[model samples]
Target: MQSHARGHLVYAASGILAVHTERGTSIVPANRVAWTPAGFTHYHRAHGDTDIRIVFLAPSLARLIPDHPAVFLASDLAREVLLALTGPRNYDDTAPHYSRSARSRLLRVLVDELREAHEQPLHLPEPRDDRLQAIARMLYETPGDNTSLAELGKTIGASTRTLSRLFRDELGMNFYQWRTQLRVYHALVLLADGHDTTQTAYACGWANPSGFIAAFTNIIGTTPGRYRTSRQTTTSGRSAKSKV
Candidate 1:
């Protein structure tokens, strides 16, 4: 989306969301929310049948949030307030004064809840250098490619030392860290699409299921199997409700 004057909180009540911005990309599942500061050009892609919800914040409310894009764990209170504020028929200019007042109160509570929630490590920082961008793009396109950093540097005509420095300076992370994060991001998508852990591990470049599970759990706060199970449950619940 084009940059605009208002910052917003993007939450998915039912499924996962992937938000791309200048800084990098962030993956927000059911338990997380992504924030985009004012004037940030960004777009979102849903991983499943997502219930995308948006809460626009005015300048005063926006100032209480990060100046850059971020992702936070959505607490129970935050989720409730967000659902209330974004419910069907939430906004009505012709509505009664009490209705408007109730919405305002709900919005305030949502902001307060977000202010206290802990940020999630869901961001993948982008590198500014052209050479690094080439490398990143290649890996992003082929997450299963087990290419070494040195091998990638040769193809990109940059020394391993230079590439290492660029990754540290621009992204504040080592090559392996960034790659692992990318793999984890891909794993989330794969798992959400009903891929098993072993299949996802290989798809994301992990040599073995154990290694992939460890890395996935470390970054995502849950095992891939459990995450997949949760997604299954959510889908089933939605289906059951639809049949009713």
Candidate 2:
């Protein structure tokens, strides 16, 4: 776990990134960007061959974003701005220098785009209660576990009613909701690993690809097939450009 001196935005241009802070884990896929406020202890885990891009925000600009960690939808303009700000100019000495004022303007545009964009539901809040934590651990370990909450409660020595209350009070979501989010998170990692949609769906605990597609679409705003294709295309494009 580490903290940054300034708030920053992290984007995964090709694969996936999970930004884990004390509060929760925010998933950053190709279509999303994650923001972490300054001094927030966090760690990142990259899934697949991720091309992670980070842009730190000045305090004045950071104030425009959420104080806590969040995941926002990356609009086309936002994505371009992020890429330009962290693009080749930073490394290729022969490339024209990216002027500070130009960078500042890009940052402003990025922030403005984010402010206009919707915050994604890619954040999985951490469970604080011991029982909730145990449940979280179980689901995290095996997202495909189709265990019922009542059955899970038995092993944890908590009644279903108590567990339900804990889920509501501590996690702010019901067991099913939390579990779905966990499953989706795992599905994303699996997809980024190049798994087929059918395989990913079943692996992530969905009984069928249709159900998985519905849930994935509901949360991610895209079908698993489309997401996979996009990732593959992006990776291929990057590879082709590298060969140039």
Candidate 3:
């Protein structure tokens, strides 16, 4: 959805989700949830068939989460509370007063659970400076490009030394680290779209499958094959339920 005054939480109960904003992208797989603060323009796309849930937090409750966008590993209690709040035939305004009170209590519990939950490494930080943004745009458009920072710097009219400093100062990551993270993010989308491990590796600029697998596992907390398999299984189950 487009950015607005209200901050919102996006969750996927049975598949994968990717959230894109000015800050960067965050992946929300099963048992994970994403929060986007108010006024930041962001959009979401599901990787597979998903039971998607959206919750808009009032200003007070939104203050409990980060001002920027983030992803957190959802606690079991948090997931249950979230599902109840966003479930089928949700609580209506015309319902009894006690029902409203219960809804308020549920909202509070969801916020509390999220507050206690640890943030995951799912967010890929985006750079704000013009020089860095130019480089980022190039890399994002062609993830498989293996151009060195020095070479890219020449095209962008900056010295490697200058660009290196900018990366550290602005994005808190060195050139290689940031590029690798970007590649990993692209790999996630490609794999989720049904590309096999070898193809994904090549598409994301890794010459060797083993290297790609290692990097994917390091950032994503799971092997690409396993990640794709789980999403496929979830999508299949949803399809079956729809047909029944």
Residue-by-residue lDDT tens digits, candidate 1, 1-244: 7777899888866667899999999888876889999989999888865667777887987898789899998888887676556553332222223376677777778888888987888899988899999998999899989989999999999999999999999999999999999999888887777789999999899889999999989988889888888767655433111100
In model 2, pairs of residues that clash are: none
Better of 2 and 3 by lDDT: 2
TM-score of each: 0.90, 0.93, 0.85
Deviating ranges (above 4 Å) for candidate 2: 89-96, 237-244
Off by over 4 Å in 1: 88-98, 236-244
Query: Which is the better candidate, 1 or 2, if ranked by TM-score?
Result: 2
Q: After superposition, how far is residue 80 of candidate 2 from its true place, in Å?
A: 1.0
Go through the candidates in order and give each one's C-alpha lDDT.
Answer: 0.81, 0.86, 0.80
Q: Which residue runs does candidate 3 get wrong by more than 4 Å?
A: 88-98, 237-244
Clashing residue pairs in candidate 3, if any? none
Q: List, residue by residue over 1-244, the lDDT tens digit for candidate 3.
A: 5897988888776677889998888878766889999999989887756667777888999998899898987888987776667653232222223386787788789899899987877887888889899999999899999999999999999999999999999878899988888888888778767789999999999999999999989877889999888777655543211100
lDDT against true structure, model 1: 0.81
> What tens digits encode model 2's per-residue C-alpha lDDT throughout 54-80?
888999999998998999988899988
Report the Cα lDDT for residue 217, model 1: 90
